[model samples]
Target: MNRIEFMTELAALLQDVPVEERREAMQYYNDYFDDAGDENEEQVISELGSPAKVAATIKADLGSQAGDYAEYSENGYTDSRFDQKEMPAGRAYQRKEEKEPPKTSRALKIVLIIAIILVGAPVLIPLGVGITLAVLGCVIALFCAFIALVVASVAVAIVGIVVFGVGIATLIPELAVGLALVGTGLILTVLGVIATVASVKLCLVVFPGICRGIVWICRRPFQGKAVA
Candidate 1:
């Protein structure tokens, strides 16, 4: 986006916001692109990502939930199980007043870890098999590289004789071609060796990425925050 278009879009957004808040938000956004002067509005917009996304993030940062005092009771003990019981008027208090552990504390972390190991261990077995296959592919690449090295060495020896009669410049092209092929073969060999090594340690190296990908794909259908 050019500067003009970026300013135009920002102007549109500011129309929906209160006057005081609008000025503050625009100044914050203007400073974001001060260093990128004379760039097209499209480029500037792309760099900033979506305007709505940025605004939402800023709004969330500025708006914090106040502490809830009514969710607790004057009594020290909190009955988390939520069984209904009549309480005296003076006993009821806000939950924020209770200085207690977070819902995701040490015990919950342990339980989640144990549950995942128990459930996911079975799923990881197939991933272990895939890594084994990748290792075999690497072995094949190494053998091909070994063959290229041998052929390249033989070619170099013959070119030495050819250079004597053909002159140094004439042999240079042939030497360059041979070297290029050898270099390509060596690079492939290295890649194959790395893949093999990675496969052997699939659980540590490959499984996490695969799991994250799957989770991301599965989550695509459910987005957008609930208004309530």
Candidate 2:
């Protein structure tokens, strides 16, 4: 075939390649033809063989070169030359279509997917929503309960201090009872303080865990990773 026919066939064969790569391939062959001159065109085409064969050879070369580059990178040596080169252009990069899917099979696959989604939506959607709501409600309830414990502890401590102060201001005739009141108030104050500290510690530990558990449950259906 003539140069035009040969180049057209080569371009068709290289359609799966990136635009720039195809262009580079075409440029190389065009240069080869020009260097050979008009009289040598036939000889050069014969040397290159069929366009399909030439495209395959180019693909093989690129694959090997890429593997070598990867190996070099793994060995901690980057290839600066590869980084510096400009890309060639043609059609966008795409995986080679080995064979087109059967039209009937493709259509059937789409219909099947749609049908499955429609049939399952009523059950799956409600179930998912219910689970999410339940998890949120539980987390909120636990948080509120912890907050209540802290509030109650503080109130009890305050009442204990007020009783102790009243006892201290009483007359000498009631001094023994006043000392007893002081002891009772001290015990209440200590218990309240302990309760407050314990609740705070519980919140610090349990709140995050609950939050994480809720997050993990919510993401489970979407195939998302759980937090550590």
- Give candidate 2 regions above 4 Å deviation: 1-107, 171-173, 224-228
RMSD versus native structure for model 2: 18.8
Candidate 1 Cα misplacement greater than 4 A, ranges: 40-43, 65-228
Error of 2 at 24 (Å): 48
Per-residue C-alpha lDDT of model 2 across residues 103-212, encoded as one tens digit per residue: 67778899999999999999999997998788779888988999999999887888788777777775366988888888778778888888889888989999988878
Residue range 1-228, candidate 1, lDDT tens digits: 565566667667557566755666666456445534444335556645565555543444334521222122232212221122321212222323447765677888999999999898888878867875776576567556655655555454445445344443434678765565555555555555555444445434444665576577556556433332
Q: What would you estimate as the lDDT of candidate 2?
A: 0.70
User: What is the TM-score of candidate 1?
Assistant: 0.24
For model 2, which pairs clash? 19-89, 19-90, 20-88, 20-89, 20-90
Cα lDDT listed for each candidate: 0.51, 0.70
